[model samples]
Target: MPQFDSDPVFCSLLQGSSDSRGSFSIDMMDYSHSEQSYIRNSPVLVTVLHDKYGNSAQITDFAPRFKQYGRVFCPVMTIRQIKPLNGSPRICVRLRPIYEYGAAIPQITHGSNHVRYVGPDMILRLTTNYSINAILDEIPVVLDEGVTLILGPDETVPDSVTEVGQQFLNQTLDYWHDWTRSLAIPYEWQQEVIRAAITLKLNAFEDTGAIIAAMTTSIPESPDSGRNWDYRYCWLRDGYFVVSTLNRLGTTQTMEKYIRYLINISANSENNFLWPVYRINGMRNMEEQIVESLAGYRSMGPVRVGNQAAEQIQNDVYGDAILATAHVFFDERLEKPGDEVLFRILENLGEKAIEVYDKPDAGPWEFRATKRVHTYSSVMCWAACDRLARIAHHLGLDNRYEYWNSQAKDMHKLIYERSWNEKLNSFVGSFDGNELDASLLLLNELDFLEKNDPKFASTVDAIGEHLKEGNFLFRYIAKDDFGEPEYAFTICTFWYIDALTSLGRKQEARELFEELLSCANHLGLMSEHINPEDREMWGNYPQTYSMVGIINSAIRLSTSWSDAL
Candidate 1:
């Protein structure tokens, strides 16, 4: 039996195959698309097999059966010998490309000492290693005679394509391994963080280096509702967290590339007054369009592409961008003085923060219908001003230090008083509403209050009691108009981890942190939410913000634990 250090779920799914010689364990997981049938119709079949000989087999029968073990069914596919090899048997499996319209058959091929295949609509070539051939050759010999078998409605490809699919799966595993090995996370949760971190990076669009909010989009926030939205674009508010996390992990290359992307987008935008919340390839004209022609995930209506929030006023973004840039400057350990362009950018942001810090804007959530003075937004505004002041002081730039400092102080003071709901004994979501926000947990890290401060401690307890669900935490209580979302924000859990560490509850913090880490999928990847009931990953895959949380929490836990020891 071959051992796999990656994606055990996939490994187990592929291990189900039986041969005349008994059963052999292949490395792969089979993920059903039925749960999310709207976005994709076909299930995903992944496996790792050894193919020493060029000879391989094709998929002959494919079926899915739902059992008591799990909500989703097991995928069964038959394989037939296509050719015989003198050396080792080849490994392979088949997959149907599930899209909105229907399924599409994909062609499989081999090249460059590996297997290569292309689905008609695939954006990139799928490749795999030679080891998978052995798995392909061991399929039940009865199924190897090219017999047709029952397949699901969503299934389009025949069993003959199994070899190609196996090839791609093997290649994918190799690609993931190579990518994971390249990352250098020195934190104590290095192994765990590295796995999650690599997944986040893989989800990034290679050409633009823009990390998508998640991997698969349109996973309904509600059941069979029109709540699905594409999360495949970049969000400025998340950029700082992503970059800072990568920096802490010593993976600066991708973050640097992302910084360049940010610079280009910010520099070239025609309407700086309205910074888009997301854009594809830095294009600001991101119009929200529904693919009415195709079904949504789980038959959820109106699968949307492009985010309308792109045009909304998210003032926190300005602060997040500045904070990320500052972190890059600080973490890179730059010895030289700050560049003129970078300094100018900071100065402009400081000026903007000073001007808009008092104004009510659509807060971080970008609530479409309401515009209020959200406390989290105010905090970030304060952060932007505070960071600028520190940068100016550090570089000895004789800019408006007094003005920036005064502005930051005023913002802080406002949040302390106006943003607090004294009656509830917790910080409110906004000045207009009494809802508590999990984002307030960021106060300690932002230095708004010491971790042990009575107010901060109370706030933490308040969030734990009001906003937490088991080990997971929601972003905030649902507003009257906005329905409650299904997924727990992964980053918020990490924030809680950081908060715990800051409060000197290192053991508790480490335990909670480990629990959160365990929420990741078999590949060490996380989505926006982990279904509390089933604990399966929901929302997008490979979320950068979630990975950022993993990295930062690990850093805090390791550093603090080491110091205590």
Candidate 2:
């Protein structure tokens, strides 16, 4: 029903169409392969253009098609568009790169490197490796008749400088097929798992190992309105889960790259104070700025470019980074080199944690106006100390053992005593107040309490009563002055699955896991949150935290299911 006046180049590449219910249906087979898996499998961006009779045209294209948008040039491989026979005012377009030399070409190829379609009110143009001059050449052709032109490069392209793109494509597919087939887990949920895995991989910027929180920036929390923020940078808290999830899925190489990214970022700290987050290229200063000129997604006002929270002292990051590194060391059987710089970094973190452990700072949520001694932050501090102590004991760093052990014990005691609210029968958000936080679920996962403990049960029950909405969970209760509460956080829902699994609620955990998996978009991507009423994704897209949650929950569910059998 809704339509665009003309299709933008970005929207003409989507591969699917919405049914009468407005539910988008996409075909995975047309877009999937292991080596090119992450790139080819993304949802085609779609835009609809309308004519005088209200007839709409659907435009779709892969993001890589916009290679000109980047400074580099790649080959154009494949681009195609389809329209409904009934003329429902929508056209479906799918674009991919041809990597294999002998691959079958559709009749639509039309024997030219570029293609153009002209209708009464709309003109569609798609070009590959066609010179920027050529692309620019066609713009006037469409605009002269008031027609719109959509254009971009195709994916899986070979290098424009070298003709090996076909060879690379073949090799990539072979590697992906072999690697995916080697997984120990059964593929009953293979389609979903592969889709999720590809989504996670795509979020990783290939040029830099730094994983972005999402691809697009400034998709508003409310409809074309408030709560716009950029998620293109790396959040240290997400690192632990992202690496852990990839490792669980048997993608050690990808996990290793992320570890390298971690090492690169962590090694840059000038003093004991490392940033809570960083830019994709390891830049420290991400001064938040509004892009006043461009209209945001759906006319969301004030398109933002940089993240302001990079400077904020989010205390949980210290623990999260250490915990993630420790998991990598443990899971990958990595030999601890006494001389590795990361070890020294851990030691420095331990020393810093001791100084700042008692201080009130921004917790995991990084609330703008308020700084509080958040319980989750303290719990993570305990976790950092615990990890450092264990690693030291394992590596025979006997000299540092006593100090770390003492600190860990002290933090554990403080969190248990001060962070718990006996009056509410739940763990409060911060030591200064009694508001329950969903993050307390981490207590069980951290093994701070036994699964069957009365306190743990009560805490879970309290969260279920207060925070759980249907199958999804909220991060925390709404605070009016803090910020807008937009949608249910995707990562929080996965955290719930993790917590439920730890508590031996295996059936409940699996059921919830399946339900959450259903929340993924057509390309198996997830945003930071989900709109409860409409089920549309909100917040950042292809969130690393959300994908990490999915992989972790899947592994947990599979392991538990196997043990029960």
Candidate 3:
């Protein structure tokens, strides 16, 4: 069972009481009053609810994050404030915390002003301004005034509840304002870009410079499709897109730290082989497992914990790892720029890319039971060498540059010869395979082919003819290990939009991009997959890949600020 199966906190109105139990009920809103909004552009959420009895309350929730001293201080604490707006709102607070994946219940203890739940491995302390006995005994309490709850590490809060909560909220709002001011957002869709940027920032694990694929696990791509997988760990390929997108927006700090993550992982590779995914702390191994005790999202079984992709042989990871690190060499904003040592480490990985550019392996899709010389993987291998040559030239290493350039030229010639089909007049998914895939649309973006290249336009046309479904694009129509995908992958639509824009189909691209933008949830957030017909998001929550698509598309399609003004 998942630890979250047990409701951690349930604070509701109190109507009646029995032996050691409280009955909670709220009258239906006869007047139908409720409002929800955010604090400016920040992540703070405030919801006001009103009942038919003229009882109203405002609930504010946010995670504390701000700059303290000279460094960013984002504690693991979350603050929730409940204040009465009208009438006497009597309520009860129920606190139940479980540990170890719902296998063990923690022992509860309380002090004068706080409650602590002690477990074997961790301790959670909840400091609130409510009555300690009322919460501990599950008794009813009067909500005549505002109440604050701070959940964090077991340590005591030094300041009073009201002072601490208000102070943190103000600071967090200011922090987001300052962060937003630094972004060079597009003239149009400024709010969308900012929201997507903040979402990407929240996905980043700053402690280790690893950005997670998503915050959720086992939220199946489609209902009961058995396609669920855990995405809590970091995929090198996803992180590359994330940092690259952020880099384009002039956010170099995230790119620099991700480069450090790449460097550390590459240095730790004893055999010069990189895993597709890793724990946020840089651990290379993640043993995938299923928790049968808890029902998955929508009562689907088999909630997964870790990811098995870490052990898979996905060759595209080499190119992704290098691509993420290449930014460190060219970006002058970085405090410690890439040096000769880092260049050499990348060269070792480039050598690996050269060895496996054409070999059969699990492609970028990571087919569980199939191995093919995927066109995307080979092109990425080509990219690894291609960027290395550029970096060598930047460092004034003539001989080294010549060597890498020669290698890239040879690989490029071989890839085009093997991957392109004369009959289709386009590049296929895998070498000699006649299927079209959305990834092939990135040929121009990757510089594998020039935008004016006739073959590139033909390839884009072929993809649009076959893979395009209304406003959405499928990753591929061909059946994989899980059979044909029922829903469209969110990022692929963005890629298609980008290809259309590059092909001078600005009107078409803009129309499709607007349709895709409507796919995001009410909070301007998106998931991994969406139903094209209904626009319902289905995969993992707040996917980094999907968020990257929003940022990149907005940047590509928006008019220049100078021209617009």
Q: Which ranges in model 1 have alpha carbons more than 4 Å from their true place?
A: 1-187, 274-276, 332-337, 480-482, 559-565
The predicted structure with the larger TM-score, 1 or 3, is 3
Instruction: Indicate whether candidate 1 or candidate 3 has the larger lDDT.
Output: 3
TM-score per model over all chains: 0.71, 0.74, 0.93
Model 2 scores a C-alpha lDDT of 0.61
Write one digit per residue (lDDT tens) for candidate 2, span 345-424.
Answer: 78787677766766787788878778888888887778888888888777677867777898899888877888778888
For each candidate, the alpha-carbon lDDT, in order, equals 0.59, 0.61, 0.83
The candidate, 2 or 3, that scores higher on TM-score is 3
**Tens-digit lDDT string for candidate 3 (1-565):** 1121112222111111211111112222344577877777788988777766877878888988999998888887778888888887666666666554444567888888999988777788989998889877877666889889887878889989989999999999999998888888998888888889888888887677888898777788988898888887789999999999998888887887788888899888977898899888888666877765446666764667687788888888889998888988898888898888889999999999999999988887788898899999999999999999999999999999999999999999999999999999999999999999899988899899999999999999999898878888889999988899899999999999999899899889999989999888778899999987888999888899998998898898999988998
Stretches > 4 Å off in candidate 2: 1-168, 182-188, 332-341, 480-484, 559-565
Candidate 1: tens digits of C-alpha lDDT, residues 88-185: 33323332222222223235453433333343433212222223343233333212233222222223443334454444334444545555566655
lDDT of 2 at 163: 31
* Alpha-carbon lDDT of model 1: 0.59
TM-score top scorer? 3
Question: Higher lDDT: candidate 1 or 2?
Answer: 2
